[model samples]
Target: MKLLSAFAASLLWAIPAQGQTDPSQAALEAAAMLEQASIALTEADSARDRVRALTGTIQAYEAGLAAMREGLRKAATREAQLTAELRAREKDVAQLLGVLQTIETTAPPVLMLHPSGPLGAARTGMMLSEVTPGLNAKAEALAKDLQEVQTLRILQQNAADTLTQGLSGVQDARTRLSEAIADRTDLPRRFVEDPVRTAILISSTETLDGFASGLAEISEGEIAETDASISDRKGDISLPVQGILLHRAGETDAAGVTRPGLVLGTRPRALVASPTAATIRYRGPLLDLGNLVILEPQPGLLFVFSGLQEVYGEPGQVIPEGTPVGLMPGETPEIGAILSTTSDGTGTDRSETLYIEVRQDNSPVDPESWFRTDKDG
Candidate 1:
């Protein structure tokens, strides 16, 4: 029983937050929600359609990862090749250094000893040409080659370092793309389902009904109801919207079959119409009200008209009385009166008629008293 009680309470709250607050706030919130839903659904479709884009991005990332790995492999290979080449160059330099040391230590003194005289070494050169004629030049050339190889090693190390950093950046990008794909898949649904966020959607239907009722201020600071006098109301007197003008003033408990008024095509957007405008309270693409508008002239007194071809304005737009709100685009019922024919027992012809209603304090009220000569509606 306790669980059931809790369930019932929750269900009640989950239903429309009834009563009234600021009409503009309610209308704006509802329309905004609808618009948001529309946009979200549109984005969802785009995302679904562009699943291929995400797929392509994923594939590209994979390919790039492969290419990065291959690049790193090549860098390592080049580094190894450079190391091997440097080792071989070092060995050649070491062998040349040894030969240079030997030649430096032994060549000059021996040549001096063997020459007939220091100045007459030309004769000794003829004898020593096979051993040491170009030994000094060979030592100098080997030293230069060793220095060049050391410089080449430094350059190779820098190149390898740069390649390593590049590979890391590519890997990071791949991870980010994967996360983005997941977020796009799940975020919108979760955002929409959040209880606090979804509460508005749950209340949408009832709120829509209130919106259909045209009163802007259902309850003032403390008044159960307040009626704005005709003097205070501002509307296009010449071209009032032609539709059933539902009246609440001077109405009884049961006002039925009131004359239908011709609600014009002009109506304030649902979000901002004055209470007196019989403004479309709530509108949507519904069955009979096909993009219908609800107008409330007084509390509990609502005029629901359906089958409008198009809607104008937004949730809280205050419009004049004669604004063309919409068209009767649906099949309306026709009135018929039976007549006794001389030849036939009875005959009846389908004739056009209008649906009408009046209410007071949210209850139906008689329209015969409130109508201005039955011509204003």
Candidate 2:
């Protein structure tokens, strides 16, 4: 859970040190800022979604390529079988030719019109009838083998073409995702140019408590506003990252310490987005946590997320729903991690966990109470 200390240290000291004189005016300004942030967040989200969709497409293509290669292998095996059969048929024909040669030194027409007489003619007719059926059957089998070989070759070529196209599609998706990440203009900021104040805040806070107190003082001047309250969207908000829910609020661990929020196991380098538009409460390293972010969906409710390798927005910024806030640390999957929506055994490779805390009136609340999806532990 993010207490006063983590909140203070991670956030920028942009809120005026002195309190605002007109609370109503400050609230109006805050609302206006949120509106701007919401607009920017919407634009950023659209771009991010496009990139995410492309990544999914690339992964799907990779799965398809694997299947196609397996099919091609099976087809090639069939072709080999047909080739072997054709060679055996050819050997049988050669043996039959040798027998025919030993039977008579004359051509087929001569044998049919032999100079010997009716007895010789009747003997030739019986021999011819016996040999004809075998020759015709051999010819028919050879034709079928040749046709099958042609079909397999065609299938192999088509599969190769499909794999090539799939590769190209994946590359395109990667390029677009990179471009979307680079575009950050749509993000709205709460901090203007206060480098000196930020530096002083960083230097002054040595302990978590001091940091929290300092931040509380700084935030006294700012106002909080949102279109909807956290309580208003209970059980309908999407998760910040795609993954399996590992734990739920009040769940105890091996140490017998009960958790105050949800723990999710997700893909490496997975994109983390804001479940809803809210002010950036905190964004930086917290004690024992890698990189953490806290959001204020409304004045009394705080949503805390930690375990990111890189962070995007600042403490004073307002972010849109679905706007990417950070990425988990680790190498992205080669075929892109599977993000199956269903509980089927399709995606089972998630290896990282994100800690999510929902606090109301500074007390930890059950996050499952607000999520649309069901929780695990």
Candidate 3:
């Protein structure tokens, strides 16, 4: 797109004779922009795929941990049951022993006084002794079983401890995978700037669908407009936008949907990325957000969406449906105002503008998805 000189070129009051430049040039530029956007789209899609795989791995670990937890629960329940039963049996054994002792001691005394009698206390004592062996054996067996239960409790504890450790490890791995996939957001930005050369970049995007596929309540970012930057690696790709939210989950009201978002950076130039590929980690308050968030996007990258003036506020690109990302760097008083529809056939309507960012983990990503496919491409 031809940028107007900051100071409108001084007008020469001469009559024009040559034909006005054809609109074809603009179309050509648009075509080029579309081509570059396509490449970015492909990269974003691939990154998403990798993230999904990592997420699945994490889920598997969680499942394993859940199973282990269930086992521990069962073991604990069994131990409790065994202990209750053992206590009951011990009480019975104690009562029986006390009665047998009383009888043996008293009966012997009575028989000893009549030592000469044929049916003497000595004979009775022998009978009691015969039964005592079996009684003692029964008590001993119960005691042994009780001790076994104690041993089982200890064993179960050990198993539970081991499983807990394993579960923690799986969780750590899952976190790493999630962070890795998120970091890919930066790839498209870098690829777009140099397409064939650059290794790292930070840019903006809009216009493409599923670009924020996994995000919650995502909306389109800035739109393509005459005054906007409308930059393209090759040509013109323009599409305006309005507010968008990733992880599009939130409460809706008559005004609009209040989706959840992490409003990063009250500080200018800090709104590098949203939750998709980037995040904020702060040990101290982010001034307005109150808490610091550390976000790991993956591939050894960490993004912190901090310096936020507010934490529970909103974020992402803004513009009419076709607004270009990062094109209108300044404020637009015509936020909700209508503009002529650029599509095939539609009446002019209204729209707003929004900024957009893509980050892999905590770094920024190029935002080219928010533009139209150039007619030529």
Candidate 4:
């Protein structure tokens, strides 16, 4: 009788717990996840396109400045030659004036009082008429040279100002680009699993990939239906972060460990975003990776963004594309921790690195082949 009573008590506790799990609510959560993922993916692509366009503008400005410099060089040469010619002409005109003055004071009066009288004066009048026109022509040439030099100087100044303004604009665009990326924080959560399992998994995992794979299995939740899958957009997505591609999949690192993903070098405190919409499966620090976040865009596919200095969003959260998920470390040795272990000959000292991994069914794949560097390719 006592054994039967204990069995009934256990059944009662199990029934309510099972009843609390609602099927319709789970489906709704899944639908919202899918819709938000689609929107986030679109936003991610647009962000990349904007960055590309801004980079192109900066390049165009640089080219224009180069052309202007070349043109200015030629103009300056012309000005130099014109200035030298003007100086010579002025010297010749000065000598001509001295001679004309001597003739006016001495030759004119002498001609008027000469034995030949009026005939000599008539000859002097004709000479004076010819010299006066030559003097007027020299004055006009000098004025033209001065005007040309003044115009060249003005043009050079204007070009310098224009180039300065263009550089300032480029700097502003760069600042705005960083700001836009950092401001993308629109993640909403439906649930978050307990951290004990995550802590245990991190402790036992040998590799980050292995740690992420374990997370994939443990972080499974309600099914979400989307219009498209991440697999459907292969080679049509943007990189999650804005920076130079420093390493590709299968590349060995400085420590001789080979990882199967792309590495990007980004600025300090740079905000990292998702390349596509996804549900946060894991967000925390690991052994080597200081702070990390894992995203489940679909059931089998997982994106591990390691090397974060700070993280936002929780597991089971649905994040839109281009949403700011975390921040890069601004200070070193923490900053140094995020830098690329492998150099593809493209990394610099001013930037830190973001390690990205894409896993499908627990297998790593090359992200470079998946991300679209250009809109078409």
lDDT of each: 0.37, 0.58, 0.33, 0.59
**Candidate 3, which ten residues in sequence have the lowest lDDT sum?**
1-10
Tens-place lDDT per residue, model 3, 1-377, is: 01111111211112224574322233233333333433333343355454444333433433343333334344455556667765755645565556546555775556344445656556555655555565555556555556656665665545534444443444454344434533544221111112211111111323122222222222133212222222232123231222223222143434474423222111111111222332221122322323333332333332333222222211221212211011112222121111111211121111222222334433344333322333210
Count of steric clashes across candidates, in order? 46, 1, 81, 2
Order the candidates by TM-score, highest first — what do you get? 2, 4, 3, 1
For candidate 2, write residues 1-377 as lDDT tens digits: 12322322322122224552332233233333333433433343355455445444433443443344334444555567667765765645455444445445757666677568877788767866665555445445555557768876665554434444444554454455556656546666554424455456657777433444444344424444445566677888888876778777778755686678877887666667788888876677766667888787777777888899877665667777766677777764342221111112333556678888877767777887877556321
- As a whole number from 0 to 100, the lDDT of residue 5 in candidate 1 is 30
Ranked by TM-score, the better of candidates 2 and 4 is: 2
Sorted by lDDT, highest first, which candidate order results?
4, 2, 1, 3
Candidate 4 residue-wise lDDT at 242: 57
Where does model 4 exceed 4 Å of error? Answer: 1-190, 216-228, 331-350, 374-377
Model 1 Cα shift for residue 130 (angstroms): 99
* After superposition, candidate 1 runs with Cα above 4 Å error: 1-228, 231-279, 285-291, 297-301, 330-354, 373-377
Per-residue lDDT over 101-208 for candidate 1, one digit per residue giving the tens place of the 0 to 100 score: 655677676745643575566654554453343444544444443454454345434433333433333234334333443344321110111333223443443533
TM-score of each: 0.25, 0.49, 0.27, 0.47
lDDT of 3 at 244: 28
lDDT of candidate 1 at residue 295, scale 0 to 100: 55
lDDT of 3: 0.33
